[model samples]
Target: MNLSPAERRAGITVAIFCIAAAALAFGLTLPLLGLLMERDGWSRSAIGLSSAMAPLAILMVSQFMPRLVARFGAKRVILIAALSDAVLLILLKITDDYYLWLPIRFLMGIAISALFVTSESWINEVTENHNRGRVMAIYNIMLSAGFASGPLILVVVGIEGWAPFAAGAIVMMLASLPMIFAKVADPPFEGTASFSVWRYFLVAPTLAGAMLLFAIVENGSTSLLAVYGVRNGLPEGEAVTLISAVVFGGMVMALPVGWLADRMDRIRLLVMLAFMTTAMAILIPWTIADPVWRLVVLFAWGAAASSIYTVAMALQGERFKGADLVTANAAFGTIYGIGSLAGPLVIGGAMDYDDPHGFAWTIIIICAGFLVFTVIRQSMKRG
Candidate 1:
């Protein structure tokens, strides 16, 4: 555990770049897949189903990730993930059939999940407690900024031909090259006893709940925001930018939230974030047609909602380390995948409503569910 200052900086740098790369692939792929399918006459339901495959893969694969990392090392896992991610992006162009997309998307999910688990575990390993909040905040910002940049790239490439797919594959490969040169220490898995994921859940149910809720809200929002915007009469270009607006909020606002996390009560901050996010979701329906106001609300929505994950993960790093940290993050990825699996379906089903604002309502309901859980969790802790 004794890392010199130079090693620490290098490790931190590698982890950040790895995470940013993984995140960029996710940001680029998710919307592009949905939009392309829609353009080819796929139903909202079918498109939503296709999107769910990735999360399903994560939920199934994440349980074994800790062991895989132990056996293979995080750096190796990351390299494989990046390489596989590139291959998967290229594979998407081989077919236009939704059924064919299901398995491809599932493989895509596994690649991204591996990168997610390895990168996060690596980052948590290198970061110290004294500045964990700020570190994670920076991590979250980079991740969000990567996510925001995807739509902007999509704007240039357009969702038409092989160009977007090639771009995605190329960037993923480029992300792997930097890590090939850095020597990241292997995780402490040799003497560590394998812990049940449920044990981690029991130790930190509130944080676990936060991860699940964040996944549901985050995926649901990013996936459908453009569709919702278009349904509400915004141009396709404007609708797509709404996602970037939200991500931009997360990119800029996460730092302040992280600074506050270091200084304030984290549980209380989480509650406040949930409350603010819910309020923003409710306002989306009202602001749907007002482009300027909608952008403003989406920005704030992104800031609050994304900070929940940032702050919660900082809390995890504060409390857990080594094998336990791996288990905790694996648990998080599994739960996040579960929520991600459901988010689009729930939102897509809600969009079936005659009201164009149903997408916002779906988000509100999910946020309310999280808010209620946090309140009850707080009450129980006090009792």
Candidate 2:
């Protein structure tokens, strides 16, 4: 896996592109996934259930990825995952019933997990410690791009039409070809299957806590803020913009945060991120005056929150390995899926009271998670 510097850069660039594309194509629709579910004759709760399956898929996928990578190679695993997701996304346009989509959504989750695991693993396996932070920063940036771009794709495709799914499918299909042609030496990160979920706290508590809390805050915010905005009296378009602002702002800031995370004390930096995000959530309901101010607040919120996922990953790289790493990711995925499930249900319920009510729930959740996280650090014996 010793690549020339130029080759390393190219490999990273390709990996970033593929991962971003994969995340963008699917992750973007999440904000409106529940709305889409309603259009097709389901409740927000049901939609949340389907969307929650994604995290569960991540949990299930990580448990098996060691063997999958061993048998299929990381590249092939990514290809199959991407291809499987593309097809399922296209099928969403064809089906209006939830019964069919439940399983479809479940499979889509698996596809995303497979794609992401392979995409990151490919680069992480090859990168030296010196360059890993920059590589991770770039990777996180691309993910932000994919997620933010999903709504824009909505503008062109409309939530009801087939066009968005087609575009998503095409992007995923195209993302795979680069790996097929590129020269890469496989450093399969394999290990004994023997491991426990609880062991993750021992291997990497910062990574574990960060992933759990961030999963709740990140996906919850992304998935529910649209409905939250509307409750606050924003026009449909502006409400949509708030979601985009958070994602784009988060994307722009993730790299700098990654750099700082790399250079400074990681736990302290993570604590800073938690406080920053919690503060932003606190500001949201209070600062809903002019549309411009609201957008700025949303942007700041995204910038602060997106770092949770990226930094948690960097922390994992900083400590855990092999089975421990996979288990941590799986546990994160499971908890994140649970968060995704709760977000829409709770937030959608908030919309019933009005938008600020939803924001209140979100704010409380953010603060509670961060506060709990801060206290948990006291008991953790750092690796």
RMSD of each: 2.7, 3.3
- What TM-score, computed on C-alpha atoms, does each candidate reach? 0.89, 0.85
Residue-wise C-alpha lDDT for candidate 1, range 1-383, written one tens digit per residue: 67876777788788888778777878889889988887889897788688778889999888778888888888888899999989988888987677888999899888888888878888878887767778899999888777767766788998888988888898899889878976766555445735667676778888988898789878887778888999998999999889888878888888899899888888899999999999998899998789699999999998998999999999888877777778788889899988887887788778986457778888888888889989998999999
Which tens-of-lDDT digit does each residue in 56-110 have in candidate 2? Answer: 6765655566557667877778878878888887787688567787778778888
Q: What is the lDDT of residue 304 in candidate 2?
A: 75
List the global CA lDDT of all models: 0.84, 0.70
Worst lDDT window (10 residues) for model 1? Answer: 185-194
User: lDDT, candidate 1, residue 4?
Assistant: 79
What lDDT does candidate 2 reach at residue 89?
78
